[model samples]
Structures are given as structure tokens and as C-alpha cells.
Target: MLHTVNKSPFDSHSLQTCLGLAKAGSDILLIEDAVYAAMSGTAVTSMVESAMNSSTIYALEPDLKARGIGSEKMISGINLVGYDGFVELAVTNDKVQSWL
Candidate 1:
């Protein structure tokens, strides 16, 4: 568990209530503005690509380049960390939930 959505699935449902309570292998990151739901075609991008078939999404590469959102507009298996890979995924994820 390491869910850390920073809001803005088009202005927050807190990333659809943290992807409906996240459970399977959870590790979603998506920092500030929730990295716009890891991009790729908006409107929640197919619910963050179907929660990446049971969670492992990440995005924080400097908050997607300060919202310019590069990485080819993300979403192909999401995962783009940086701040030391978000402190190595909050120190290898024992728990880090922060949906707000």
C-alpha cells in the first residue's frame, strides 16, 4: 500500500475516491494535482487505465514537469517517479495513503 493521489481528477473526487478504495497490490502515487490522473486522454483516462489491472500506477516526475505533462502525455503503464523516486516510494511502501 502506497496510495498518494494529490487531487485533480478534473478538480478532485480525490482521484475517484482513491480509485474506489484501492486494494489489489496497491501502490499508486500521482503527486500534485494528481499528475492529472496520469494523463493520456483525460476524463480519468479510462479510470486510470482500469487501475492498471490491479494497481501500480505512479507519476511525479517533478509533478509531470510542473504540469506541462510530458512523458509523451503519460498513461502507458504510468510510472514516472522522481524526487528520488518519491523517496523510493515512501521507503518501499509499507503504507502511505494520502488521497486528499
Candidate 2:
């Protein structure tokens, strides 16, 4: 499954809920403000790291750049993807569950 989270962890529990319900081996695509959770020093860092153990995590590059978050600011192992990559992921996965 491809789980897309667009809410900021600092503002909502949607990311946490997605991480909790996402099965092992699922793909997590962080978009919009959710990219904040993938930053190195955020409060949700530990939770993101924990989720990494069971899921392949990704973040939208455009969204990160829009928020002034560079690739260097991202946590280790979280892949950065462009819009095409996002489309590829969507096509690759059987389903997409968006956490609004």
C-alpha cells in the first residue's frame, strides 16, 4: 500500500495514525506540511525513525523546497521524490490511502 500523509505532525496526529495503521513493507509518502516530520530535529523524529523500520518512507521534494527544507535537513533513509516519482509510486502500489 502507498500511504500519503499531508498534515504536519506538529499540528495533527494524522501522521501518527497513518504510521500506526500502515502495515510492514508499506510505502509512506510525506507530502505538503507532513514533510516537516521527516526533518532531523523535529519532535516526531523518533516516531518517523520507528516507522522507517517497517516501511519505505518518502517525501515530496517540491513540498520540502517550498517549506525551505533542504535535502540535507531530511532524516537519514527518507527518500526524496519528485512529482514523477510520486506518480510512479502511485502506479506501483495497489492502493493509495491519503491521510488528510
Candidate 3:
């Protein structure tokens, strides 16, 4: 399964809720303002990092760039993907759940 979150963790609980419900081995894609959660040293960093133990966490590269977040600011092991990569993930996963 693939879970996409587009809300900022600081502004919404959508990312946290998605993380809690996403099954092990699922793919979690952080898009839009949700990309903030993929950065290191944030309040949600530890949570996101812990989720990586059981799931693959990805952040949309374009979104990160738009938010002025460079790769160096991102947490290690969190994959950065482009629109094409996002499409590939959606196509590869059997299901996609969007957390607004």
C-alpha cells in the first residue's frame, strides 16, 4: 500500500494518523507541506524515523525544493522522489491512501 500525506505535521495530525495506521512494508509519501515532516530535527522527525523501521518513507523532491528544503536538511534514509518517481510508486503499489 502507498500512503500520501500532504499536510504539515505542525499544522495537522494527518501525517501522524497516517503513520499510525500505515501497515508494515507500506510506502509513505510526503508531499506538499507534508514534506516538512521529512526533515531532520523537527518534532516529528523521531516519529518519521521510527516509522521507517517498518515502512519506506519518501518525500516529493519538488515539494521540498519549493519549501526551500535541501537534501542536506532531510532525514537520512528518507527517499526523495520526483513526479515520475511518485507516479512509479503509485503504479507499483496496489493501493494509495491520501491523508489530507
Residue 91 of model 1, lDDT score: 91
Off by over 4 Å in 2: none
* Candidate 1 RMSD computed on C-alpha atoms after optimal superposition onto the true structure: 10.9
Which ten contiguous residues of candidate 1 have the minimum total lDDT? 7-16
**Best-to-worst TM-score order:** 3, 2, 1
Model 2, backbone clash pairs (residues 3+ apart or across chains), number: 0
- Residues 1-100, candidate 3, lDDT per residue (tens digit)? 9999999999999998998999999999999999999899988899999999999999999999999999889899999899999999999999999998
Error of 1 at 41 (Å): 1.3
Pairs with backbone N, CA or C atoms under 3 Å apart (clashes), candidate 1: none
Q: Work out the TM-score per prediction.
A: 0.33, 0.97, 0.98
TM-score for candidate 2, residues paired by index: 0.97
Per-residue lDDT tens digits for candidate 1, residues 1-100, read 8988888788768888888999988888888888888888878799889989998998988878988988787879788878898888889988788887
Candidate 3, residue 94: Cα displacement in angstroms equals 0.6
Instruction: Tell how far residue 63 is off in model 3, in angstroms.
Output: 0.4
TM-score, cand. 3 vs. native: 0.98
- In model 2, the worst 10-residue window by lDDT is 65-74
